[model samples]
Target: MRGMKSRLLTRREMDDLITKPDLPSLIADLENTPYREYIIGAKGRLDGILCIEAALRDNFTNTFRKVQDFVRQEEAERYIVIFLHRWDVQNIKTILRGKNIHVTSEEIASCLVPAGEMDEATLNELLKQPDVRAVVDLLATWKIPYARPLTRAYPEFLKTKDLAVLECALDRYYYDDALASVNSPGYNNQIIQDILRLEVDVINIKTVLRMVRDRVDPEEARRYLIGGGRVFDERKLGSMLCLSSIEDVVKTLANTPYRFLADLPESSIRSQKISIIEKELERFLIRKGVGAFRLEPLSVASVIGYFWAKYNEVTNIRVISRCKTADVSPDILKEELVYV
Candidate 1:
């Protein structure tokens, strides 16, 4: 994991990629880094942002697999596998969203990263389903655990045609399962729980902002809040949900670890540009993941830390590549990146 972490792009390297004049230039520059092989392989059959994104995704998946292979201890591997299941949640969400929007199966397939317990074959099977209902039915037919929540939420999803209902179900299930799996008394288990709790808080924070922005009733919004967050409980989240605006909700966070949200530019909050707030929250989590390495170098924290660092590197590259394709200014592109 340390070796893999060492290969992560430095700030200067990321800056160099950010300044590339075009997609081709960015690809050329990437060939000089550890991503060279992936870039070369992807360039053979893809182009532009797709090419870069494919390379990045492939590299990330392989890197994570390498990390999994490195861990020989069963207990340690269990925690790592739990962490990897987030990708399953992510892949399922992507497929569901694609099916929701009626995108091409190939297009949806491109967006998936099969790095979790759900292998590529299973994801491909889900992709083959004719529609969202078919996908859910297939999961239930296969007896996959995630199918249970989706099955329960399917009727509500049918009534409202709202994908969030299913998405929230998946999120709730993932967190609950993860917490249960790591419930044993150990420092590593505690570390994993701390990270998961913060994640729940982050998700809830985003949920609150979205609900307030959309003028959803606070009572209705409460249904979407996942339990087991580290900081905000039901009372605290409910209080934030009752606020009239995103800025007001952020102000309610003034005393918490997320006080940084309150410190963001008033203009950003006033304008309801929640993406900036989301990015900051992500960076906050990345900082926690990275810090775990120094705090528990021999434990699963190091693996988690390396995973975050690698994930950040790939995300930054993808952002740069997409910006280059759009001819966006480097300054604006830098703003979009999570530098940690």
Candidate 2:
């Protein structure tokens, strides 16, 4: 067997460089590619993330077979290529989910992507290390503006398993770094700024909603609100706080560009700690939000989208199987599911 060489790529260009790759015509059939579209279109409902995730689990069966086929065809290194730095926050959450439920080390193994900057073994080590501080330390190798933000915010995270706040902090941290990295003086790349900022806008609204439901003070809520803006200015955030009931918060957000989540249940259920509805909402949007960013002819947007979608698919499968093992009814499962 010949040795396969990996190339240094900035997410977008890496797809062209995968070992024993699929042909241009084949990959181009992305629209006809059943699962992505299946995922993209399903984002309308509350369970849209679940639906995409279900589709991913169903599809991963095929991906597994493809890996099997790769070996049969003597192409052993053919696997999903991922950009880990961008999605490390999601990875941390997924790992945390597994550990929280007492999933054994070996059983929790396959869900990992194994590509990207962070090593799987290191991440697994993070799971067993205990507490969010350990998780932050394990990620010390990340070495970016994102790493520092999370590092700075870790003390607060250590104090609370308010998983939503922890999650919001990490996510808010990661994107802040991404935004900083992309903001070059010469390059007027509006697309890069747009995606990062829009993501922040979305997360801020969700965070604010959940915080309001939690009765978190406006001052405290400010901590969870890291960089990325233009949508969620002081005026909007203050206005959101002024609204009393969850219904009014929903209505107030509707008047803004953030009306996307206005349809989701804004009742106290939105602020749940354990279920952490924010992840479900975020996972769904990131997967199908192909056009929101301006990368073309297969670029960074596709790469980042793939990273988000891939993890959601893995996490979704994990949730479904857990439900299945517990013999949860389809109806109850459906209610909790981010369904395709």
- Which one wins on TM-score? 1
In order, the Cα lDDT scores of the candidates are 0.89, 0.51
Per model, state how many residue pairs clash.
0, 7
Q: Compared with the true structure, what per-residue lDDT tens digits does model 1 show for residues 1-340?
A: 6777888899999999988899888999999999999999999999888888888888888887877887867556876788789999999999999999999999998899988988899999999998889999999999988999999999999999989999999999999999998888999899889999999999999999999999999999998999999999999999888889988888888889999888789999999999989989999988887777786678888888887788788888878887777889989988888877
Q: So what's the TM-score on candidate 2?
A: 0.57
Off by over 4 Å in 2: 1-83, 93-115, 127-147, 157-169, 185-188, 260-288, 292-323, 326-340
Q: Weakest 10 consecutive residues, lDDT, candidate 2? A: 1-10
Candidate 2 shows a clash count of: 7
> Could you tell me every candidate's TM-score relative to the true structure?
0.97, 0.57
